[model samples]
Target: MRMGRLRHAMVCSSNQNRSMEAHSLLKRHSFDVASYGTGREVKLPGPSLREPNVYPFGTPYKHMFDELRRKDPDLYKRNGILPMLKRNCSVKLAPQRWQDNAADGCFDVVLTFEEKVFDLVVQDLSNREHKLMKTVLIINMDVKDNHEEAAAGGKLALELCQELEAVDCWEDSIDDIVAAFEKTNNKKLLYNISFY
Candidate 1:
């Protein structure tokens, strides 16, 4: 709304997949978008379910990609991590933690793809000092963490953003917008208002 487009933040447990997928889509649509993770460490699938490759928040996507490819090119490629990292590298330099990004500035809307992440984002916002006194809408639409689900969720997130963009005053029309979206998409959404 600031520049005739809603500034958005897409969040998930790890910025590598779901959030990044939506981030890419939103960026392509020319939305002011940023993506983040709620997890303490960035975690990705390893060779087995019991093992996961972990990195600190600031590790470059290229580094993770090269390291994973070196560790097991075939396995990572098969599991879609390689391709995901390649796509992530193109979207941004690294995975960022939501808690660590308070100074990154305000967003008009923050969308999380998981309930836990929504909680984390809400908690983070609540704990911050409300210097801007700006109201931000936080919405959660459950999205499964997988290639197909991420792709589908990205499109759905785009649709929701477009709906919001079309409104002259989002605050006044949010209820109707959410109701229409839920009825049409058959998806329940959880939303809250927080200050920036």
Candidate 2:
């Protein structure tokens, strides 16, 4: 009964359309669909936490990286390969003046974090002079957006991470966010993180 309740709770936070379509597709194909959060309880995969696990880098990048490690090991590992020392540490959306500054042969992934997280990642990336790559991947996690879309957002699962939402709960207008993801093929992996 406890497990049953938990499963329902997990499902409840999923996208309605995506869930229904995925379930229907899986059933017809004799498959299954499961979901989870990417932060808190999750131990950063493969590689343990870096020396400064508690990022002054802000919440979004921290949570996003945590979630990435939980879901996509290879991608996360690639991320792990990037220069551990952040050069710059902040990002923002430029309206109209957005330019194509991306060059070739950057890191294995091209991405961005949300709001404050983006700011931190951008600042570090810019400071580094794109040492990670011509493009900097902003790692971030969605702790809120309690609405349908952000339902899969990672909640702080760490006892030490009690202030999960407090960190990543910023709302900003990053117009090219989805475009960046699509262009880079950087996917939002399942939140495999869990706590007993």
Candidate 3:
């Protein structure tokens, strides 16, 4: 385990250094920043969800919520309204983003299928001081297009993602997620180090 962790650390370090080298280019470019760690213990859906929840329906707008309530009543009831709704809707709290609303901030990502519906989502995660985000990413399951519509979809997704938020479209592990970020033009290291 120690060796495994050491290996992870080294790979991460090397990748991070490469990212550092891109600082000048990134500054000139428009990179999206995000960090994620995978856990098979909670492999509810795809690669990386902006929130922590992993429900079966994946949308809070309708049928999914009722489905979850019926399927996992025990797990559903104990978690409470927001969490239950999130779980049923396949959403979860954006850790850093939610505090402000608790502390008097705003709303964030509510739906996942459209950008025009951005404001409907709540901004549960934000660090105005650093511009860190709520749902740092929105992992998807498709990667087959490099056309204008696809690029537009990416931009729209970016729009839905908070100003400093992020999104991914993969089914791999966190290492792949990090590598994707590093290899893309949208990789930003918003908060490399933290007090916690």
Candidate 4:
């Protein structure tokens, strides 16, 4: 049984894939969860990966989904993009940036699916340490951008959250949280689609 509520932030490069999946799953499990993207400019697959439609961080999901559906129906449908976008839209209106939540300081744990996003969030927090001087555990778990990989990552995140909830010292130290997460999820691989 959960002792109390925990606020979590899941982040990735585009916010449309891995983090969003984790966000949805986490929320379903009754955690106060938010998802963000670390990209300076939001990107979506167009006719090809070589040419993607770029938007800003707060761009509405509906608009981007419509654009993608219109721009490249074949690629979008083939890659199972609409279902993800629809699920995102059902949960939230737009994508948020890591900077957007820094001022609020609402999250107890922040999980990033990629190293780039992890570094960006760490640097962002480091620059404003005085203003936001709270113990927020940040973890970098290597999860791929594909759907299968994202679902697997979401499962890992849910398991970690459950494990952390049961730990008494999870909030005291980041090292303890990481150790518990790794120990609880030792059999699961970080990058591949396992435990799904």
Cα error of candidate 2 at position 160, Å: 29
lDDT tens digits, residues 107-131, model 1?
Answer: 9999999998899889888998998
Give stretches of model 2 more than 4 Å off: 1-106, 110-113, 131-133, 137-151, 154-196
- Candidate 1 Cα deviation (angstroms), residue 191: 0.3
Q: Residue 83 deviation, candidate 4, in Å?
A: 1.4
Write the residue-wise lDDT of candidate 3 on 75-185 in tens digits: 545544324234223222221121212233212212122221121222222233434333223223121222333334344334323222332331224445445544564
Give Cα distance to truth, residue 92, candidate 1, Å. Answer: 0.4
lDDT of 2 at 76: 48
Q: After superposition, how far is residue 106 of candidate 2 from its true place, in Å?
A: 6.5
Lowest summed lDDT across 10 adjacent residues in model 3 is found at 5-14
Q: What is the C-alpha local distance difference test score of candidate 4?
A: 0.75
Report the candidate with higher lDDT, 1 versus 4: 1
**How big is the positional error of residue 36 in model 3, measured in Å on the Cα after superposition?**
11
Ranking by lDDT: 1, 4, 3, 2
lDDT of 1 at 118: 94
As for model 3, its CA RMSD to the true structure in angstroms is 16.9
Error of 4 at 171 (Å): 3.9
